[model samples]
Target: MDHIRPLPAYLVQRYHGWRATSFAENRSWYRRLADEGQRPRAMVISCCDSRVHVTSIFGAEQGEFFIHRNIANLVPPYEPDGDHHGTSAAVEFAVTSLKVAHLIVLGHSRCGGVQGCYHMCSGHAPELDEKTSFVGRWMDILRPGFARLPEGDDATRQQALEFEAVKVSLENLMTFPFIAERVESGDLSLHGLWNDIAEGGLMALDPRDGSFHPV
Candidate 1:
C-alpha cells in the first residue's frame, strides 16, 4: 500500500475524458452492465501486448468479451493440483460459469514472449533458461509450438511460431475437461487467429490443413 501511487497524469486525464464523454453518453448502459453483470458470448485468450487491442479490433462494446491475457497467450494443459492457475481459472469461469459459446486464441506477430521462447529454445537467451526464471517455466508451454517452427528465415520462423502459439493454445484449451465436453456437445467452438501488427492483417487457422489463411 505504501508503494502505491496515484495514476499518471496522462492516464488520469484520459480517464477523465472518457468518463465525461463515453461514460456520460452511455450512463444507462453502464448502469445496466453493473446491475446485470457481464454476459459475454466469447472468451478471448490473447497476449499481454499493448498493441493487441482485442475490443478495438473486434469493435466490441463493454461486456461483449471475456478476455484473459498472458505472456505469448499460452495456455498450459489442464492440471488440477490445487495450485494457483490464473489462465485456467479464467477459462473455467468463462466456460462453466459464463457459458461462453466461443473461445478464441489470438496470437500476434512480433510477440516478445514468443520471440523469447524461440531464442531460449535456440540457446540464445541464457537468462530465460535459468531454473528460477518464471518466464522460462511459463514459456515451457510453447516448446511444442517451437518444435513445429518451419525451416525458414528469421522473419518467417518468427511469424510461424506466432501462428503456432495460437494453435498450441487452442489445442491446450481442449485438454480442459469442461471445454472438451462442451465442444463435443456442440455447445462451444474454438478458433485460432494470428494478427500482423504492422499491417493490421488477420489470419485464421484452418484446422483441416493446420495452416493459417487470411481472415
Candidate 2:
C-alpha cells in the first residue's frame, strides 16, 4: 500500500514523549496486561469525535475500559444477518467474551453525524438520500430518535436528537439477547451520557425521569 504514509512527525514526537514518561512508568503494568490480557470492567461506546476523550473523561487507566467509537456512537438493532456489522460485533464481543460489567453509550453536543441525520430526515440534506451514501444508510439508526424530537428550531431539534441518540442506543443494546439477559440477572448495567464539548460539562440520563442531569 504505497498510498499509506508513515506516522506524522508531531504524532511521532508525542508517541515518543508518552513512551518515555507514561509508558516507562507503567512498563510493568503494560507487560502484565500483555501476559494476562485485558479485563476491562466497562464497555464504552462513544462518538469518533476527537474532542470527546472517553478514557480521560473517566480518568480510566490502561486496560480498565473497553472503548468502541463510531460516527455517532450508535448500536443498531440486533440483526444476525451474517454481514459486516462492526458496531454489533464489538458489542457482542464485549458482552459475551469480555463479560463487561457495564455498557455505556455516550453522546455529545454539536455532533456532525447527528446534525446530518437531522438534516437528512428533515429533508435538508438531499445528497444523503442516495442509496450509495454509506453515511446516510448508517444514519438510519438515528431516524427514530429524530422522529421522537418535538418540533423546534434547528438548533433545539439538533440538541434533542443528540440526547435521543443515546437513548436509542441504550434501547438497541437491550435488543441483544445476551445484554438483556445480563441486565436482568444483574450482571451488567447500561448507562447513557451526554457531553457538552464547548462547556466541558457532562449530563447523565436518569432512568427515573428519562431526563439528563449534571454529573
TM-score of each: 0.98, 0.97
Off by over 4 Å in 1: none
lDDT of 1: 0.94
- In terms of TM-score, how similar is model 1 to the real structure? 0.98
Each prediction's RMSD over C-alphas, in Å, is 0.9, 0.9
Worst 10 residues of 2 by lDDT: 143-152
State the C-alpha lDDT per candidate. Answer: 0.94, 0.94
Please give the lDDT score at residue 151 for candidate 1: 94
Model 2 vs. true fold: TM: 0.97
**Tens-digit per-residue lDDT, 1-215, candidate 1:** 89999889999999999999999999999999999999999999999999999998999999999999999999999999999999999999999999999999999989999999999998999999999999999999999988988899988898788888888899999899999999999999999998889999998999999999998
What ranges in model 2 sit over 4 Å off?
none
